[model samples]
Target: MKQVEIISGGPELLDIVEPLWAKLNEYHKKRSTHFSHKFEQLTFEKRKQNLLKEACDVTINLIVDQTNNAYVGYCICTVNKEKQGEIDSLFIENEYRKYGLGAELINRSITWLENYQAQTIVIGVSEGNEHALDFYQKFGFYKRRYILERE
Candidate 1:
């Protein structure tokens, strides 16, 4: 198996990132899915550009690829001076799940935050995302708070 490499995201990667983001969004939109209604309030285009901008400067958006250069996953890390650093978003293709890409992304984000002298790192997972919660807990993250909304 080829090692997964991390690359800086930029205009060159928009073509790839946009499609991946869309797919993830679609997955999140499926009402029957665990990710549904969790991120529906967010706008895809605006969020994508914001993430891209963050990568261009202070924050880091890591694009993971195979040694063969095929893209596999990505994560966005943002430093919040008022709080701990934040993992803005993370996504790995369905075919790539259970392969440790998610854990690698979290580790890389934590390293980036520490390098920037951040006090800690924070990530938000939906209430029903047991898999995600488990993944984060495996890395020492705990539920700090709960967010509820009436729909």
Candidate 2:
């Protein structure tokens, strides 16, 4: 097994992180059909810009394979003026799933937010992603609200 290193940085690392972000978006689109329509409305450049914007506001952490210097996963987190932390995105490549990388990413995000004096931290799990929800729950995150949509 290759060693995985988590590196913390900002939007300056966007180029290296964009591919993972794209994969995450695709994953979500597949898990929830509703997201497909919203995804289709945005051009690639627009999507990239939106991702860049999100990355700019938060701490971006990349999980890399030290042996081969490959980017395999990423997490985005930010703290608001209200002292609340939001984990905007997190994704790990399929090959890396069972290795505790996701938990490490979440721990780093929580630590970063806590450093900012965040009183609460929230991660948004897609409605149908029970695996992700269960993963976060292991770290004490629970359902606090629901979002209903209509079109």
Candidate 3:
């Protein structure tokens, strides 16, 4: 086990995010939990680039494993100036799952939101992602509303 460090997103960090995005997307697909899997058009690069750009105003935290210089996971949060904050996305590399990385990322996101004076945090997970739902709920997150979708 290596010392894990939490840091803000930076240019040098895209390398980590790009691979993590691919791994996470693959994980979701293999589990048949990717909401857009049917479309088969969600480009990982586009999403990674968008998230990197979005980091300018939003809070994105990465957990890096010092021993191997690998990005174990990341948590993204967006703060509304006057409303609750949003946990945009969170994913831990499958191999790194059980080492408290996900929780640490969530903790950092909450800290960032609190700094912005947000009292509550909101997160939306697709219905098919049972692991995510369970993870968030384990941290005391309750389902606030059902997001309905129509094909």
Number of the predicted model whose lDDT against the real structure is largest: 2
Worst ten in a row by lDDT for model 3: 32-41
- In order, the Cα lDDT scores of the candidates are 0.67, 0.78, 0.71
| Tens digits of lDDT, candidate 1, 1-151 | 4466777643455556666777666665763244466567656678866755544224445456555677777776776545467787778877677777788778877887788777777887654555678778888899988776655
Q: Which segments of model 3 are wrong by more than 4 Å?
A: 10-15, 33-39, 48-56, 81-84
Better of 2 and 3 by lDDT: 2
Each model's number of backbone clashes?
0, 0, 0
Backbone clash pairs for candidate 3 read none
| Alpha-carbon runs more than 4 Å astray in model 2 | 42-57
TM-score of 1: 0.75
Candidate 3, residue 145: how far the Cα is off, in Å: 1.4
Give the alpha carbon lDDT tens digit for every residue of 1-151 in model 2: 5599989987667677778878877777677755666644655467547655543256889999998999999987876566778888788999998898889998888888878878888888874466777789988899988887774
